[model samples]
Target chain A: MKPTRVTNTIRALRFAHDEMTQADLAERIGVTRQTVIAIEQGRYSPSLEMAFRIARVFGVRLDDVFQYPDSEEVAP
Target chain B: MSKILYLGEAVVTHEEKRAWIMLVVSVIAYAGYVAVVLGRQDGGSLTAVPYVGALLWTVGGAMVASIVAEIVMGMANPRASRVKDVRDREIGRLGDHVGQAFVIIGAVSAMLMAMAEWDWFWIANVIYLCFVLSAVIGSLAKVIVYRRGVPQW
Candidate 1:
């Protein structure tokens, strides 16, 4: 199977949300700020619940914020 | 900050009791070991009494610290450390990797030293340095794994 890396527009989304800090985002999602950071840096991919929580924060569809390496197929 | 996301606090549990315990025990053991090693020098002062005590103290300290850590973690969250977490497993994995690296380096260095006309100091340093580096790297690896999650084995 493929080792799919998480790719996200979280930085852009945060900026659009009135320059919300990583701390702000993490608090809203009920996880640590470091977790938000790891997610943004692609060092960590959050749980599905966390992903949805993040998407909801930016008021965007999950796909809008998070993209798979392959545009057509499901993530590995 | 927004409650939905950045609760803002990253409160890793306080293992102060265990930490302090380890700190005192470790310091004393290290001091004892150093004293014994130094006493055996050319300007030797003490007898072999300190050497025996140092060995016992170091081994005892390590064993006690391990148990204390386990107990403290168990108290903090019985479920959390029920089995090895992603963090511990990752740390162990990295420790194993670094340990293997040190073993290879030590073997090569010792072989080279055996063939060459060098003092025991060089060979001793090689052996000591590998052991220390493996431990330090292993400890740092634990911190990294805890900070950054590892889902896969």
Candidate 2:
């Protein structure tokens, strides 16, 4: 199966937001630090609810946090 | 304070390490049981062998070893830092499902052996082997899943 096309701005956002550590973000999002690392590295994709939760932790909209390159290409 | 330096970078996540411990404990326990049983067997039918004591000892020992290993791992890592998240849950379920398949197979085989009037020793050993296979295979699956990213589905 093709790899997940989902990507996120978690690393950049974390840096922009007071240089937040991965553990700090994980604690805020109620997930393990390793999970945060995986998401940052694009090895795992979070569920929609988790995606919204992550974005909420950073005080951003869902789209601002995650992107789908395939969806973008399909857009008219 | 001096900076800590290691010869090589060895990094294993807490879950992965737990899986490894379980795999090792199960294999060692099962091997020990088999060795003792075979060593005690005289020039007689396998059905005459006394296997109950060995089976019980191995089962209990494996349980204790697994518990002790988990405790040691917990002590080594800070409790607050050890977290089980979505990926961990998914991997656990996947491993459990794979292991459970062996359990059903073993049960059916034991039932058939019993119907055929096979030796009680064989039936009991088959059941014990199934349990061990479940644990070893399940732990192995978990370790592999942790190493290789969880299936996309």
Cα lDDT of model 1 by residue, B57-107, tens digit:
565766686687767766766633132222234346765685567767887
Docking class of 2: acceptable
Highest lDDT model number = 2
- The structural similarity of chain B in model 1 to the true chain B, as TM-score, is 0.50
lDDT of 2 at B148: 58
After the best TM-score superposition of candidate 1, give how far the Cα of residue A58 lies from its true spot, in angstroms: 12
Tell me the deviation in Å of residue B18 in model 2.
2.9
Worst 10 residues of 2 chain A by lDDT: A67-76
For each candidate, what is chain B's TM-score? Answer: 0.50, 0.88
